[model samples]
Target chain A: MHNLEAILAMGLVTLLCRATPFIFFMKRKPPAVLDFVQRYIPPMIMTILVLNSFKGLRFGLAPFGLPEIASALAVAALQLWRRNALISIVGGTGLYMLLIRVL
Target chain B: MHSNSEAPRVKVLGPAFTASIPVLLGYSTIGIAFGLLVVKAGLPWFLSPVMSIVIYAGAAQFMAIALLAAGTDIVQMAILTLVINARHMVYGLSLLDRFAVCRRWKGYLIYALTDETYGLLTTVSPPEGARSESFYAAVSALDESYWVAGSLVGAVIGGLVPTEYTKGLDFALTALFVVLLVEQIRSIRRIEPYAIATAATVLAFVLFGPANLLVIAILASIAGILAFRRRLP
Candidate 1:
């Protein structure tokens, strides 16, 4: 029962956050402060997300985040070149898997 | 008779599917990962799709596994859900104009606005000659369906794979995030946001370590942006 409740609670909270803007802006223009947030936050969030992925890697440890670093670099370069998201992801993951096994 | 009526609506499906193919790949792999983890944690098969439907936030679901394992309560899960997926509001706000005219689908649209869907919608316009709402609806539904289907498959197959064999399969999610991050950077023109955000993440990691890093990074990024906004412009 609690598990189900937790799921519903999560869904409801998610719905509320998503609905907040649409409801608030239904009758009025969003404020300038919101405009600032709208403009600047996406990149910041994206950067944070990218960093979040590697948070488990101990920088000072033996493998030293090398596989992640190499794969990330490969992802960036491949994406920049081909502009194909699927290629970048697959290529990077493949390289990461290989590096982890080899090194 | 039903087929005749459905013809126009079905025409929109192709573009939507094409646009969503990348997410189909990302979500399927990550959804599988989350499903496998949940199974490893001793949950039932149906719970994977249930959680995917309700707690549709992909990244947050990964975080939730730890809490679920620890037997966290509903209230705590709700709060955690809010904190992690709070970014959805930003994406929602950005699309307020586009979504305003899409009133009837607003609820459904908001519900399906995950990061990959949001990013894809940001880049791609509605298909030519298609009903605008239909295009958005198609893309949204397709993405979620990919996730649900993936989780369902993952749930069924999860127990079959030995734990040792699943190593580094988890990197698919990270690789997907990196791919989207690259997409975000390409769309964005400035260096300051990236630089400031990097510094904030590094500083937060150093100060707070991994446990509190998310809250710290979010705060630092927001603060850094506010303080530096005037300077930038």
Candidate 2:
């Protein structure tokens, strides 16, 4: 029941979410201050997200563990190697899962 | 700028509908994962779509599911959702350029300024002398259509599939992030983002416990950015 509700609700929200921005800003470009803010903001937000998503403080050999840290490294390498979003995801997640179970 | 007085409306609408195909495919995968998570969290599957429509934030939606599962209060859920998605405030900032033109549509744009759409728009500057609003509208519609379709597909699958198979589906979010970050790193000549992310992540894990690490990460990254601002250009 919950799944069903989530599916329907999320579907509409997703549509509206995608639509609202264009609907509002389709006619204009952001100001200089906004451009500046956009430039610097994502790094901070992403940093916070990555830190909070971690499972543990200490892992096998170092502070970073096999799951997230390894995945992060994989993402960086793959991005440098391929420059493709889908490929990096597959490589990073696949490697992370395999490492968690194997090592 | 080509005005509606000269250009046909269908000309603008056609591209928006067509571009949604790829967006739809990506949304489907994530939507399915979300559907599965909501169900696993023991919330009514039907209600998931409602929240998805209203809140419309991917990360926040997932967080909402977790909160709902834990029986979190409604007020707490709302506040947390707002905090987690505060990044959208920046997204809004970027849209100000295009948004100022469509005075009547401001309300809807504020509602729909999502991460994916923002990613697509901010990176792609419109051609000069073109009617940007039409193009923007098309992209926005395409993105929304994809998301809606994805959620619907997820719900249908959730209704049919067994619970065990869906257990591992929540991974789509992390996988998506990994992919996006990788893309960012690929084109990024400035290593500051990488350095900041790494240093902040390490410092956060060390000084603060995992729970408080998010705040530390934000601080460290900001500090890094401030320190290196002169080198950005």
RMSD (Cα, Å) for all candidates, in order, is: 3.3, 6.6
Error of 2 at B83 (Å): 2.2
Model 1 lDDT per residue over B155-224, tens place: 8896565656546655765666677678777777888888888999999988878865765786688788
Q: Which runs of model 1 end up more than 4 angstroms from their true locations? A: B1-12, B63-71, B124-133, B161-170, B231-233
Give the C-alpha lDDT of model 1: 0.78
Which portions of model 2 miss their true places by more than 4 Å? Answer: A1-37, A42-103, B1-27, B37-43, B66-72, B98-109, B124-143, B162-188, B205-216, B229-232
lDDT of 2 by residue, A42-95 (tens): 544544444455544365564247566777677667767876555665676666
Docking class of 1: medium
